[model samples]
Target chain A: MIRIQGLRKFFGRQPVLRGVDLDVATGEIMIVIGRSGGGKSVLLKHMLGLLRPDAGAVVVDGTDITKLRGAALEAVRRRYGVVFQGGALFDSMSVFDNVAFPLREKTALGAGDIAQRVEEKLAQVGLVDMGHKNPAEISGGMRKRVAIARALVTEPEIVFFDEPTTGLDPILVNTIHHLIQDLHRTFRFTAVMVSHEIPEIFEIADRVAMLHEGVIIETGDARGIQNSTNPIVQQFIHGAVEGAHHVA
Target chain B: MTDWSAGRETWPLPARWVEALGEGTLYLVESIGRFGRFLGQAVALVFIPPLKFRRLAGRVYFVGFKSLTIVILTGAFTGMALGLQVFLTLQRVGSEAFVGPAVGIALVRELGPVLTAVFVTGLAGSALTAELGIMRITEQIDAFMVMALNPMRYLVVPAILAGIITFPMLTAIFDVAGIYGGYLVAVMLLGTSPGTYFGQMQAFADMTDVMVGFWKSLCFGGLVPWVCTYKGFHCGHGAEGVSRATTEAVVLSCVLILIFNYFLGSVLP
Candidate 1:
């Protein structure tokens, strides 16, 4: 489980995350929904140890990741995988080489072993035969799939995806949602996703957490979302600006 | 914790001496460590396979190609000026025949490689650092890091390897073009016999002098790009951060190249 305690963050003088706290259980898919500049990404970065809290701690499993330094932090990072907003595939490397990169760099695996593992992961992402393709030559959905494959190649216990479906078409978005659900079910990997596509997220997420005004005001099972009494949750879920979440 | 007390001089002579000595020693040790690691990494990668033929050849073309005309022009002008200045000084002492060898050796041994290295350091060196720095700021370096890769081992080692392996060739090119430029001036403009010029150049300019400069340029090539990229890659704040990193990379590359040149020249046989 990942637990955040009294996490506070700021940019110069303005607070982005104001003493927020939450928990993500092992093997659960949690979707964090919020408006633009609503600190959803900040929360994810903190969890990933890319950003440190000004006042709080992030504990992954039993270790306080915020306090992890050097090798300890790297050890923490190895257990989880991160897919950036823009796929972030190394353009210089082919798709198979990209996925094999981490294995070759980090582990003692031979080239043959690395190649086999990469192929298996690519197959898992349904990117079978496209292993040698360059990222630019592939479609947007395929790049994301490659990114997901690269993320999962190490067989991370937890995968964090930021805006996984942001720029894809609805069909591609639905396809990625299905893939996420399939991966969640097949591997039972803990997944934390930051995205704004509400209904799609509802379809895949085991639970949805709504962050409003620098706080996680609501978190519950997908079925319980429609009946939320919190105005922030209701408005954010339905895309209604009249009740709460000022459009400005 | 940068210490200001160490910079002061009002203390007792022994205390002041100790403080200055300590600071200087630390500086020397740190610089040595940095350069030592640079050499270590370069030496190790010199024999590695998957030699990145396309990328290495591409970088060589860029670093060596785009700077070719500029290096030749700079080299030629400096050569002619050195020849003229040497002529003036030698005429006063009746050792004017030595002019050919002196300027030839000077241009070939030190000036050619060093000047070309500096020019390329400013151009290609800064470009490498800024490109990597931009990647760092955009989280591309983080992307590499998250993949359990070492940016130094993967990205840096290749470029440094390329620079060291290619600088000597570029230096040789620079030396030849520079001497040829001096020949054009010495024979055509100054009326010196081509025979005398060639004779003096052959007899006095030894391999040691020329090779020292070549080695220096090779070292300069590796040092400039490595430090520039290191500074830029470590820049972490934002857009302003990347911009600062780019500028810092360029400035540091030039400064370190010149400074190391001075020290290496002083110590080398």
Candidate 2:
């Protein structure tokens, strides 16, 4: 389980997160939804221990990760797989090398084993033949898939997705969502995803948390969120222009 | 109009100016501190275990071997020009035989290392900055961090070590090429006797002069890539940020090299 309490962050004079509290139970898909630039990504980064909170704690499996540093922090990070919004594949490396990088750096696997594992991951992502191509040569959706393959190659216990379907076309977004669903079903990793795909994302999410003004205003199952009475929640879910959220 | 003194603030402009100056100074100091910290980290990582020979070899090839032609051209042209000027200036005193010594000493003590560093800064330093800047803006550096890889170890140490190892070698090439160019001008074109030219150069240029040049080159090697890589690693986001960082890296490296050259010349025995 991942637990966050009173998380806060500030960028210069601007406060991005203000006492945010959240929890992700084991073996469940928790989708964090918010408006653009509403600190969803920052929240995700805090969970990954990429950014330390100013006043809070992120406890992963009963250990406070914010206090962890160096190898300890790295050890916690190894349990996580993150798919960035832009894929973030190393352009200097071929897709094969990009996927093989984590294994080569972190593990003592032999060359043959690494190659076999890379092949398997590539095949799982439906890019078995495209391994030789550079990341720049592939389309964006394919790059995201490659990123996913690289993330999963380590067999992480938890996976984080940052706007996995933000820039893709509708069909590609659906495809990626389906891919995530299938991967979750197969791997059963505790998934924490930040997205803005709305109703489509709701289809795959076990729980949806609404982040507003640097805090989670509401968190519940899809049906509960859809039927929520809170004006901010109703305004967001129905995409209405008139609500308490408009005052901000 | 009646009470302008009471309405207006007493020290608004001066206060604002002072505030701006303070902010700028703080920013500069913070940047210097960050660079120093990163340098320490890179140096520490260099001596640690898991040295990456393959990456180091590749950087040497790129930073040294590929940079040879430009260094040679710059050194040769500068030497030829200096030879012609020295010969003409000394011709007035009927002591044109001293042209070889003048050219040789200048090349060995100063021009060889300084010119090589300038050329490399423009050529390879800019490339390093741009490459790393792009990597940063594209999130590859963060990806390295997320993968539990120390970019300071994997990316920076090899490049810095390669620079340190290659600069002296490159300066030597530059010096030799420059001396030959001077020889060509003094002996073949200016009608000076080859024995006089060679003998004077051999007599005037000693080990101290050559070693000083090599030392300067070594310092330049360490500093140029250090500044460039630091800028690249800490560059702001997006295309404009990368471009600005590349420019800053080149300008800063060149400036630092020239400044260090002056100080080293004054201090080195």
Candidate 3:
């Protein structure tokens, strides 16, 4: 569903993404695992047309989103929903309003229909009775679930999760991961997630891709990645402090 | 490639000064151009269809109605001060009746619009900058983009429209309160004849003066939101960045209000 080729980005003279090339198949969960701050989110943003690459192309389906502008880019984006690392819920809105926002702004659906849809999404995320509460009033895990509900409310064909479980506790992480897997099974939308939840991500991801420095170093099925001989991948999967990739 | 700036420390002091001046000039010019572009985009999107009336009404409440108490209080105090000062000066010259005209002309022509704008810049403008800056830093804006919503239309156009509509209204309120304040001080306290005071004010302060104030208020209304929204939209990351953006928005708005005030004063009449 998405193809990124020769993606290179730099911050001034400092290179962040250096010639990355990867592909994600439709209706599959593609989880990108990498060291902290290794430009995983940057790659996801390129796919969403949120950030234009310094060089290369992010082609979604057939169109190179990198070159698209204004209405064209916006039309391409209509098929996407993104869950930012911090949930990024509008603080001024209640949970119900946050989920209802996309539908309210984009659709011609009646008020009763919009409310029904928003309530259904809230139920899917297991926050059925928490609609009236503000994001600040909810716990962090609940907030993440609210964000997921908001992202999926539009029933987007493609969804991007940028470290959705970064700060959650281990048990909550498992629950959220399972929640995501169940949703994917039900919705069958193509997903590209950037995560640090190593083993947890491995269990859910159909294909695992490891990013190092700036490029995708390895890409394969979850078992193929586990059994692969790549030293960097092995070291990362095992959580080794000193390995093929430097820590500092 | 030659790196001319690499050894700049070895250059003469005058050369360094010249380079610094050139860099400052370039930065200022670039900022002006960028702000002009932002202003253009804001204006273009403001009247587009599917206008979000709820958002516009919310902003009006914030940018206009919320600032009412401060505007009224400030207006009253300013008029009283002006009246007291003018009355004492005219009393010495046996021209106390002229206090009403002097105070009326000053408030309607200069003080009303200028002070109201500065106050709104500090109150509404800074709040807007902070709100937008936080939204930008938190990736809420990115969410808007991915959802196919135009952030400019969602966030900025309403603010600009609310500003344009409310500034004149608020300025008018300020003028009325100020005139009443002057009446209390000059007529009630100083014992000037009420007829002479109002009669002279009506004759001296014409519709042209009122129009001048109206135009100035309109320009200031647009300027405050333009600068504030731009600053917030492009603010740097984190809490410190949001704070800095808010401060810059207020400061820049006030300065521009004063500058526009002087320019319009000279050009309008």
**Best DockQ among the predictions, by candidate number:** 3
Q: Which runs in model 2 stand beyond 4 Å of their true positions?
A: A241-243, B1-21
Please give the range of 10 consecutive residues that has the lowest summed lDDT in model 1 chain B: B1-10
- Per-residue C-alpha lDDT of model 2 across residues B1-269, encoded as one tens digit per residue: 12223433565998768866887999999988999999999998888889889889988998999999998888888888888999999999999999988998899889988889889988988899888988887778878878878888878888899899999999999988887888889889999999999899889888999889989999999998899899999898899998999999989998898899999999987
lDDT value, residue A171 of candidate 2: 97
* Model 2 Cα shift for residue A28 (angstroms): 1.5
Q: What is the Å distance of residue A15 in model 2 from its true position?
A: 1.2
Which regions in candidate 1 have their CA more than 4 angstroms from the true location? A108-113, B1-98, B105-110, B161-169, B188-190, B198-219, B235-244, B259-269
* Per-model TM-score versus the true fold: 0.79, 0.95, 0.95
lDDT of 3 by residue, A1-248 (tens): 89999999877556789999999999999999988989998888889888888899998899999999999999998899888999999999999999999999999999999999999999998998899999999999999999999999989999899999989999999999999999999999999999989899988999989999999999999999999899999999999999987877
Q: Report the TM-score of candidate 2, chain A only.
A: 0.97
Comparing 2 and 3 on lDDT, the stronger one: 3
TM-score of model 3 vs. true structure: 0.95
What lDDT tens digits, residue by residue, belong to model 1 across residues A1-248? 99888888877557899877788999999998888789998999898877888888898998998898656888888887888788888887899988997887678999889989999989988999998889889998999999998888888999999998989999999999999899879888999999999788889988888887788888898888768888888888788868755677
Every candidate's lDDT: 0.80, 0.90, 0.92
How is the predicted docking of candidate 3 categorized under the CAPRI scheme? medium
lDDT of 2 by residue, A1-119 (tens): 99999999988657899989999999899999988889999999898877888889999999999999989988888898889889989988899999999999999999999999999
| Interface RMSD for all numbered candidates | 5.1, 8.9, 3.1
Q: Which has the higher lDDT value, candidate number 1 or candidate number 2?
A: 2
Q: B121-168 in candidate 1: lDDT tens per residue?
A: 777877777777767765667777665444555567667766777777
- Writing each residue's lDDT as its tens digit, candidate 3 over B1-269 gives 12357778899999999989998999999999999989898777866687878999999999999999999999999999999999999989999989888988999899999999999888899999999999999999888989999998989999999999999999999988998899999999989889988999998889999999999999998989999999999999899999999999988898888899999999998
